[model samples]
Target: MQPNQHLRILTISSMLMLVLSIYMVFVYAPLEIVMGAVQRVFYYHVASGWIGALAFLITLICSILYLATRNLKWDHVALSSVEIGVVFTSMNIVSGSVWARPIWNTWWTWDPRLTTATIMWLLYAAYLMLRQSLENPQRRRTFAAVYGIVAFVSVPLTFAAIRIWRTIHPVIIGSSDPSAEGNFEMTPPMRNAFFFSLFTFTFLYVTLLWHRIRLEQLTVQVAAMQSRLLNKLST
Candidate 1:
């Protein structure tokens, strides 16, 4: 089978999975007793967070691969991972903000999770810009790989720092009860929706990453062909 055909199948499957997840979230999931309709946003919010976390992890791995092999394909994979990571990270923040508005009584806050996510977004943005500044492809890849690996060190630190800070300065409401912060007890239907959302988003992530890497490959091929054409014309 052709490579493009395989990609097409994956793409279709991802779309179908997303559609199914939406159905499960809206129709099948039970309403929360506490937050009502707004609580539904948590499914997508958490899914985005999960994908973002996975993306950064993949970025770290691909960065190591690029450094070891000096292969441009690894660089492509790293770039694709960062780009997709940024997309999901943004989604996570936005959805979280929406969920917080009704529950937290504010659109934004310096809560641990919110602050950590913001910092992560900025770190990846810097990585993307770093890639743009260099003229040489090899140097660009090398620097980006280094940055990808190094930037990830902050992820763990950010999480730990947030947890520590929250402990020192806890939320007044339900601060005593750990569950009060995001503590909606899930009914069986809610649990099904939550798990289904996670499953669907994971499939979507794989599907997007595959297509993005293929596009990068095609781009390299096109550039090589164009360069060859130019050389022949000049001769």
Candidate 2:
């Protein structure tokens, strides 16, 4: 199949899955006895958070490969992952804040999980800015790769912050601290919807990443063509 055809299929599938996920969340999933309708946000919120972490992991792997091989393609992959990570992480943070308002009685808090998450987001944002500041392509790739690897350290720290330290943030899957404010048990249908949301978001992430990589490849091709044209004109 042609590239455009493949992309079209992916686009259609992603949209369908997304629509199904939304219906599952609002319609299929049962209302929480305590949190009521707001509890539904947890599905996509956690899914986005997972995708954010997954994106950082991909960045770290690409950064490693770039450093070892000195391949600019890997740098492109790393940059793309960081860009996606930032988008998903921003979604996670905003959705968490929205979910927290009614449950925690405040839109913001300095809890360990929240604090580390904010720091993680800033770290990746700085990664993009660092690339922007550098003029030399080699220097930009090297520095960005190193920074990307180092920045991923924050991902694990952010995830473990809630598990290791006391926090008001609720733990959904595992044993949470007794003092956690918004923890709740999931019913069978909620569980199904939750897992399906995860699957849907993961599929979406792969689709987006594929397109981003293709865009990067096109960008490199364009730059090369421009350089060759300039050289010919000068000759």
Best by TM-score: 2
Model 2 segments more than 4 A misplaced: none
Tens digits of per-residue lDDT for model 1, 1-235: 1468777888898899899899999999987887789888888887887788889989999999999999888889889988998999899889878877777778888866677778999999899999889988889899999999999976776555444554322232233334335566678888888889989988899989988898888888998999999999999
- Candidate 2: give its CA RMSD in angstroms: 1.5
What are the lDDT figures for the candidates, one per model? 0.82, 0.93
Q: What does the lDDT read for residue 7 in candidate 2?
A: 80
- For candidate 2, write residues 1-235 as lDDT tens digits: 1388888799889999999999999999989999988999999999999999999999999999999999888988899889998999999999999999999999999999999999999999999999989998889999999999999999999999989999999889898988899899999999999999999999999889888888988988888999999999999
Instruction: Spell out the clash pairs found in candidate 1.
Output: none
* Sliding window of 10 residues with minimal summed lDDT for model 2: 1-10
Alpha carbon deviation, residue 1, candidate 1 (Å) = 13
Summing lDDT over every window of 10 consecutive residues in candidate 1, give the lowest-scoring window. 167-176
Instruction: Work out the TM-score per prediction.
Output: 0.90, 0.96
User: How well does candidate 2 score on lDDT at residue 218?
Assistant: 91
